[model samples]
Target: MIPVNEPLLNGNESKYLLECIETGWISSEGPFITRFEREFAATVGRKHAIAVANGSMALDAGMMALGLEEGAEVIMPSFTIISCAAAIVRAGCVPVAVDSDALTWNIDPTKIEAAITPKTRAIMVVHIYGLPCDMTAINEIARRHDLKIIEDAAEMHGQTYNGQPCGSFGDVSIFSFYPNKHITTGEGGMIVTDSDALADRSRSLRNLCFLPARRFVHEELGWNMRMTNMQAALGCAQLERLPEFVERKRAMGKLYTELLQDLPGIQLPLPETSYARNIYWVYGIVLKDEIDFDAAEAMKRLAAKGIGCRPFFWPMHEQPVLQKMGFFKDADLPIAAKLARRGFYIPSGMALREDQIREVAGMVAEVIR
Candidate 1:
């Protein structure tokens, strides 16, 4: 089967890893980790970047940095990975799901105002599928409410808004280094921000809340969320190739658009112009009601021909866990819910070649033909 994603390694990753091994600095405390953080901060246009064990931990640290009181509500898009909510919950905050815009598949910035309450402490906006969210509107609303904006920019490494990189716009932003990401370290994550306090807090938290490197000067309770030297080595190498990776992903997206444009009843997702680049981390397709095949049937048909297909993330408000909590009231997010039900993404890996794209395109046509 054509896999959903692949990690392309053209960096001096092996060399860096070998250097780490030679120096006996395989642990989180190593030169490459610091170098990775510094270089990444510069690349993303952030004041500081703190390396973490994974993207989820980066989110968790971001929430913690906000210092929300217990039960404080965090407004976020329902159409996002569970990691967004999981991180909020981990930091003793409640995840308040809001519907997103159908076009951008991003949190509806206009809807954010209504979700805010006296207890609402933060707003976490996710750039779903590497499509940039309406940051201008979102940022304005956040400023009016004196609310903190946390960007879950994991899937949008090279994406930007109004010339500002996604990770640099929000009050705090997180990036993922999983294999399928724009860049990878097998399994790693990073947090970036303009706030010195948040940056310092993140560094401390990732290293067990140690004061300037711990070693018995522990101040607050923290976790072992540090990224290892090995991960950093890969991350450093991946950084060098990130721009090309994004360009390749966009090229594939354009190809998919051409291939799928003529299909009746198949609605394609478009990138918002606000985004400097829409790197197609995954290509989402929505089958209209008039379509003969629903999302499930489409997936089954495609899989038979050795193609991989998957549905969108089930809206957080509809998930059984949240439903049981009675936390999910009438979310009024019709667009997001509908998209969740019928939307599915196909393979759009940067590593996928022209012939591979053609093959996947053919399989898609056959599935819904």
Candidate 2:
């Protein structure tokens, strides 16, 4: 089967891992952790980078470091993963949902101001799929309102926005290093920022908020979300090949576009926006409104043909857990809801070859058309 994603680990991954084992420095306190954090910070143009256990923990640590007042609202894309809202809620804040752009599929900046209120403290800018949210407009809104920006760059590892790196936009930005991502640590994440205070706070939050002077005494609660040296070793190796991996993804994207550009009953991902070219984090396909079936049915058909696929994020406004919490009761994000129902992505991993891209594209065409 042509799986949705498979990590490419042809770099010095094995060598670094063997070094970690040979040196018996496999714990979180090992040297590779610091080296990974430092190199990642430099790559993302951040002053500091705090390594964490995973993406969800990165979000949790990042939100806690913000220290926002309870009940303050955070405006975010409803099309994003539930982790964004969960992090805000866990940090004692409310998440305000916004619709996505029809073309770009990122959060609609035009709808943001309408969601802002007196209690609004931040805008959680989630760079969805391949392209980034329009940072130029979002930055303007945040500046005018004096709101904090938390950039979720989970899917955009090597992406930039208008010549600036994506993870450098917000007060705190996060990345996930899952195997499906451009870079992989097997399971890891990083929180990066220019503020020393935020960086220190994130580090403390990832390590259970231990006091520097005291060993077992903690003034505030935090999580044990530290990344191990072994994971950092893998991360360092993956980081070395991020640029090459990005090019490969783009090459696959270009091939898919060529193969299925004219396929009926589907909307292809836009290759580029005015600000930035798509990095094609995943080769997302949105079934046109005229299509008889939803993404779920389409995915089933693709699977029958040995083409593995995955559905898009369900809108946060429609989440059952959030519904139970009495949030987004009156939300009306039509675009996000429609995308959730119709969108799914095919094979677009780092290890995907040109032949697999053609086969997936051909199968998608046969299934959807």
Candidate 3:
């Protein structure tokens, strides 16, 4: 059966890993790791990029760098991976979620003002499915309220908004190097920021907050979330091919839109025109309300046809952990709930074969035709 994603590994990846092994500094502090961070910073146009264990930890570090007190609220979209909201909570901050926009499947900036309170400290925006949010409005709201902007740009790497990178918009931003991301380092993450103090703090926090040279002093609490040199080796190779990967994903997105446009009960996700270029990480095709299938049933049907399909993420508000923690309450996320029922992720992997994409489109059209 066709899988939702397949990380394509080129020959250079193995070569890099072998080189790291030959050097015998394969832990975390090697040439590859240093070069990876520097290269990533240059790629994102940020002053510093701190390599960490995973995306969640990068987010937690960013939150910690904010120096906000416990219970400070950080507003984020309800419709996202649990990690986005969970990181805020893990950082001793409140994860206040708002509704998502139906068209772009991004945080509805229009709904943000009401959620703001005296306790609000930050606004985290996810560039969902590589489609950018209304940064103009989100930035304005943050400016008015003096809230920090933390970009959970894990799904967006090379995409730009009117010539500005996604990670550049926020005070601090993060990217995941999971196998499914634009570039894979197996399991890795990086945090980018312009502030040297925040970068140093984040680097310290990820490395047990160890002092510059004194290794034995217990200063502020920290975690060992440093990325391994092996991951960095792979990251270096992947970074070199990111632009091509993004272009391939965008091409597939265009193909899917054109191939399935005439099919009934199929609706394409609206692209954000404000973004100078869209990087389609997970291309979503929203089935019409009249369709007989919810996302689950749709998946089962697709699987039966020897094809792979995934349901859209469940909104954070609908999660069981939120209810158990009493952190989530009734919120009007009608669009999120609706999309969660109808939306499912199509195979948009950069390495996905064109024939595979075409076959998947054919299977979809067969069902909805």
Candidate 4:
């Protein structure tokens, strides 16, 4: 069966990993960590980048660095991964969620203002499926309310918004180097920021808040969320080939669009918009309301045909864990709920070839028909 996702590691991945092993710098304290952080920060146009164990930890660190008070509300999209909300809740802040835009599949900026209350301290803008959130409008709102912005650029590595990089817009931003992301380090994450204090605090937070002068002593609580040197080595290699990877993704997106443009009973992912181009992190399609089946049935059929597909994120408001915690007591987001039930993405991995894409498209057409 064709895999839903496959990472391309043909660059200096092996060479870097070999170097790390040969130099005996496989741990988190190796030079590759510093080198990767420096290069990644420069690439993202950030003053500082703190490497972490994983993307979830990056969010946790970002929330900590913001110094949000307990019970402070952070406005974010309900359509995002659980990590976004988990970080806010773990940081002792309340995550106030808004629904996603039907077009861009990103957080609806118009709904943000309504979600904001006196207790709201930050706006977490998660660039969904490689499409950037409406940063201009969101930034304007943030400026008006004096709220901080935390950008989750995990799905968008080389994507831009109105000519500005996604990571550059937030007070603090994060990227994941999970295997499925544009870049891969097996498991790694980064926190990028322009604020010196945030950067320092983030570093401290990732390293157990151990004071530099005192080896084992700590002033506050923190975690051992450091990225290994081997992981950083892989990340450095991946970073070098980012431009190539981005172009490949665009080509794949275009191919999918062309192949499935006229397919019936489904809404395809959007192309370029005025604000940002759709990088098609994965080529998702939402079954029309008239369709007889939801994404689960569609995915089952696809898998039966030896084609791989994954469903969209279930809205946070609908999650059992969150619901059991007495959260979202009065929340209702129809758009996110509909998309969750109907949306699923076909194979759009970097390693996917044109023939495989055509095959997947053909299979999808057959199933839908």
Candidate 5:
């Protein structure tokens, strides 16, 4: 069966990994970690970048760096991965979620103002599936309310919004280097910021909050979420090829759109918007209401045809874990719910070839027909 996702590691990845092994700097304290952080920060136009064990930990560190008061509310999209909401809840802040836009499949900026309350301390805008949220509008709202912005740019490595990079807009932004992501370091994440204090605090938080002068003593609680030298080595290699990866993804998206543009009973992802072009991190398709089956059945049929597919994230409002905590109780977000049930993405990995894409598209057409 064709895989749903495959990373393209045809760069300096092996050379760097070998160098790390040869130098015996395979741990988190190696020079590669610092080098990777510096380069990544420059790449994103941020003053600082802190590498962590994984993307989830990056969110956790970023939320902690905010130093929000207990029960402070953070507004975010309900259509995002659990990590976004989990970080807020773990940081002792209440996560208030809004619905997603039907067109962009991103957080609806129009709904953000209504979700904001007196206790709201931050607005975490997740750049979902390589499509940026309306940051121009979101930033305006944040400025009016004095709320901090946390950008989850995990799916938008090289994506931009109105000429500005996604990570540059947030007070503390994050990216993941998971295998399925545009860049891969096996498992790694980064938190970038312009504020010196936030950067220092994020570093401390990820490293057990040990005082700079004293190694053993600690002033506050923190976690060991450091990214290893080996991981950073891989990241450096991946970073070098990010631009090319993004272009390849865009081309793949165009190819898919071209192949399936006239297919019935499906809503394809938009290729471009006025704010920014969709990077097509994954080529998602939302089955129309006229379709008889949900994404699960569609995925099953695709798999049978040797075409790999993955479903979109389940909305946070429907999660039993959050429901038990009384979050989003009685809240009805129709767009997120419908998309969750009907949306699934075909093979759009960077490593995917033209033939593979055509095969996948043909199989999807057959299955849907």
Candidate 6:
């Protein structure tokens, strides 16, 4: 089967990892961790960056570092991964979700104000797929309301909005280095910010709140979410090749669009918006109403034809875990609900070859034909 994603590791990933093993500096205390954090922060135009075990943990750390009051409402998109909402909940805050823009698939900036109340303290902007949310508009809203912005740029490693970087917009922004991301450390994440206090708090939280002056004494509870030195080694190597990797992703997106443009009954990812071109983190296809099957059935058929597929995120409001919590009382996010039911992405990884793209395109057409 043609796998949905296969990361390309042609750079110095193995060489850096060998150095880590040879020097016996495989733990989080090694030099590569600091180097990686510094370089990554510079790349994203942030004052500081804290490395964590994974993207979810980075979100947890980022949210806690905000130090919002208990029960403070954080406005976010209903169409994001559960991690976005889970972090807010873990930090003792309520997530007031807004619907996605029908075209952009990012948070609807227009719907944001309606969800804001006196309890609202932050807006968590999650850039979806490869496109960024309307930061110009979102920033204006946050400025007027005096709300903090927490950007999730996991799917956007080398992407920019207008001319500025995606992770540079919010007060505290995050990036995930999962295997499928533009750059990967196997599994890792980062928290970046311009605020010194926020950076210090995030570092303390990731390391279990151990006071620097009093090593073992802890004043506040925090998680052990530090990324390993080996992961940082890999991250440093991957980060070197980020520019090329981004080009590869964009090239892959273009080829897929060219091949699948003739196919009916499905909608392709938008190549570019007014502000920025899509990096195409994953090439997603949403079935039109004429297609009588849901994404689950589409995946099954694709699997039967020796092609791998993955579904879009299930909306937060429809989650059984949150439903049990009595959230989303009579929610009405139709676009998100429909996208979840009909959307799935085919193979679009750095390792994918031109012939494989052709094959996948053919199989997709056959499945929907």
Better of 3 and 5 by lDDT: 5
Better of 1 and 3 by TM-score: 3
TM-score of each: 0.96, 0.99, 0.97, 0.99, 0.99, 0.99
Model 3 lDDT per residue over 1-369, tens place: 888988889748999999988989789899899999999999989999999999989988998888889999999999999899888988888899899988888999999999999999999999898788889999999999999999988988888877787788889999999998999898999999999999989999999988887887977789999999999999999999988888888888888888887788877866447555557898888888778877788878889998788889899888998878887777668888888889998787767998998999998887765
Residue pairs with colliding backbones in model 1 are none
Which pairs clash in model 6? none
* lDDT of the candidates, in the order given: 0.86, 0.94, 0.88, 0.93, 0.94, 0.94
In the range 1-369, model 6's lDDT, one tens digit per residue, is 999999999889999999999999999889999999999999999999999999999999999999999999999999989999999999999988789987778899999999989999999999999999999999999999999999999999999999898899978999999999999999999999999999999999999999999989998999999999999999999999999999999999999999999899999999999999999999999999999998999999999988999999999999999888877889999989988998999998889999999999999999999
Tens-digit per-residue lDDT, 114-231, candidate 2: 9989999999999999999999999999999999999999999999999888899989999999999999999999999999999999989988889999968999999999999999
| Candidate 5 whole-model C-alpha lDDT, 0 to 1 | 0.94
Write the residue-wise lDDT of candidate 1 on 1-369 in tens digits.
998776788679889989998999999889999999999999989989999999999998988987889999999999888889888888888889898887778888878898899998889999888678888888888888888889998998877788888898778899998988889999999999999999988887887786765488876899999899999999999898888888888889989989999988888878546445667888989988888667888888888899887888888888777777776777667888888878999987657788989999888887777
**In model 3, what is the error at residue 119, expressed in angstroms?**
1.2
User: Which 10 consecutive positions of candidate 4 have the poorest summed lDDT?
Assistant: 272-281
Cα lDDT tens digits, model 4, 40-91, are 9999899999999999999999998999999999999999899999999999
The count of backbone overlaps in candidate 3 is 0
Model 1: residues >4 Å from true position, as ranges?
Answer: 211-214, 217-219, 271-275
10 residues in a row with least lDDT, candidate 6: 95-104
Candidate 3: misplaced stretches above 4 Å? none
Clashing pairs in 2: none
Q: How many backbone overlaps does candidate 1 show?
A: 0
